[model samples]
Target: MVGRELYRLLQCPTCNSRDLAVYAEYVLCAGCRNQYPIHKGYIDLMPRQTEFDYISKYVSEEESMGEELDYREMAPPLLAAGVRHRQIRRMLELKPTDIVFDNACGNGRFGLWNADAVGLLVGSDPAVLFADQALAEMELAQADSRRLPFVDGAFDKSLSVDVLEHFPRDVIHDYLVETARVLKVGGRVAIFSNTREMSPIQPIINISKRLGKFFVKQGVYDFEREARRKSDHIKDLKTWDDVEAALVEAGLKPVKVVFWNSVFTSFVEHVLMKLGESLIAKRRTAKAASATVLTDEAVNASAGAQREIVARRAMRRHLTKSSPIYWALYTITLLMELDLWLFGWMRTGPYFVLAEKVEGRYVPAPLPAEE
Candidate 1:
């Protein structure tokens, strides 16, 4: 039954045809006669030619970088993918029978975390490594977000976290339109992304980055790769109003908007990150200088040990009844929560927009007349 349902949702990317049949390990489209292979439990639906050269390069880099880090350990508690997933679940009122689509699901963290709660979870990403990671828990496909291969109205909800900003400015609207096309009428979509308004803590972060660079010169830090990672944000959204306008133009009705991660929380998290990275760098430098041979297993065990120590410290801090720092952080968090409840639409840190697809044929917004 599940396999039949999955078959029904798939369509030919070239022809947008539903005349599809499942062969041994390929989905064949009778309309275009295109055969898409199923590899490692994921259907490869990526089109042969992409609209932009940058898209392919970006996806390739993402896949290559996937082998470098353990995202679960590096993610901070304040802005973790789990944190975003919980917010999406609450905002969309996700139910056990809900069919959810996670568009541009890099690493598939959100989908994997909530797969057990939803009836069907499908994750689509251009990066094949992300699909490979998600295949254990949910149906995954290697496809562009702007050209999803699913049938219209196939999903009950769609969620995208920190994905829109990576797209070129010219194609963001197309991505939203595709998001609406795959969702059922009145189905909700949630998007979380960084805005153009720099958070109050951003200046401090910049200062820290400079300090980090200086430390690198002194052999106390190494952040050259991290510095290069910042170039991925090709399209930082300017404002929440712009986001809402894009959704409305794409045939989705805006439902709820909220901002979170206040200045205080961000500052604290930055400090923690800097401290952790410095310690790790120091250890690596010492090991290298001493010519100490460390096996991959040993290195992984050390990282795991460090993560456990940090987790224990975090737990103890939260549990401590009379600690001043704990109370201060708690208060700051409460204020941020209140700010979201009171003034989410106003410019703040990262913001979320929840919208529902409107019924009717979606007419693309007309291009502006020539001056």
Candidate 2:
């Protein structure tokens, strides 16, 4: 099991020393005399929280709503998330004997889903809690990605999703350095995050967003609420070239690059699915005894719990295997994947990338120009 050699991979985030003492209650750092508390199933390795300029929703919102939401019932590799996760898995090219790290592993969504397929999974994030299923299947840690508490060349491979947007150029290179530092030589890491540019199919996305706003005009997907959520948090707006340059600087050579958030994903998720969820939330509000509609902020704040309830129900239907709805969803997911095939070559919007750790300098390969 991964536990047998887990300490071999871990180090002190403060002092970067591997002289750690593991105990029933905590892991003690010999160099810094810092004790990391082991609770619920994850080690808290977040550095001085005050130094952080941006706070993740996982740290702020999810922590408060933890009591009402059972992470064990949550599904990560389903619906829209599944689209990104599928591409990530393909980029990772996982192996049964490889030790993998899920960096920025929010709620262990991908880790929990792919745990059985790999030898071991170590999910780390700043503040997100792990599901019971993940605790049973993988090691969970609360660590900052920029300063991971892991020894150099610790993992065979890693995957990070939705992390690049939060890291500005000033900080993102540090994160990439840490990422490359933890991977073994020639080891590959899968990355899924966005650039600042518009997608090749931006017009289609415009149409989809407009359709959703016009038809499902509801509190759940309000524009102002979304702006409030993303305006500050998504500060990393570098171009693909800038990101690739940084990756090379960190000794990680990008081997494969494919983009997402195009025609299929935008229409299916932004328009169709949002439309359905908005309608459902509206009906639920109307059926309330007081018949009071929630404010936009309330709708956004409670979205996690609401979606989980729906996910749990869908999980039951999926477990049936014979249910027609299960196949319906399966088919829709497959259909969504068509966007990857259609738009993968185009360098635009969010992307899934596979990069390997190399010793020498890495030269950038020019992707086919979109023009």
Best by lDDT: 2
Please state the error at residue 306 of candidate 1 in Å.
14
Each model's number of backbone clashes? 0, 0
Error of 2 at 314 (Å): 6.3
Worst 10 residues of 2 by lDDT: 289-298
Go through the candidates in order and give each one's C-alpha lDDT.
0.66, 0.71
Every candidate's CA RMSD? 6.1, 5.4
List, residue by residue over 329-360, the lDDT tens digit for candidate 2.
67778888888888788878688889999975
lDDT of 1 by residue, 89-185 (tens): 7787888999999998766777777777889888888876553346655688878877789999999998998887776554687788899999998
> Model 1 off-target regions past 4 Å?
1-4, 49-56, 67-79, 131-133, 199-226, 280-345, 367-371
TM-score against truth, every candidate: 0.76, 0.83
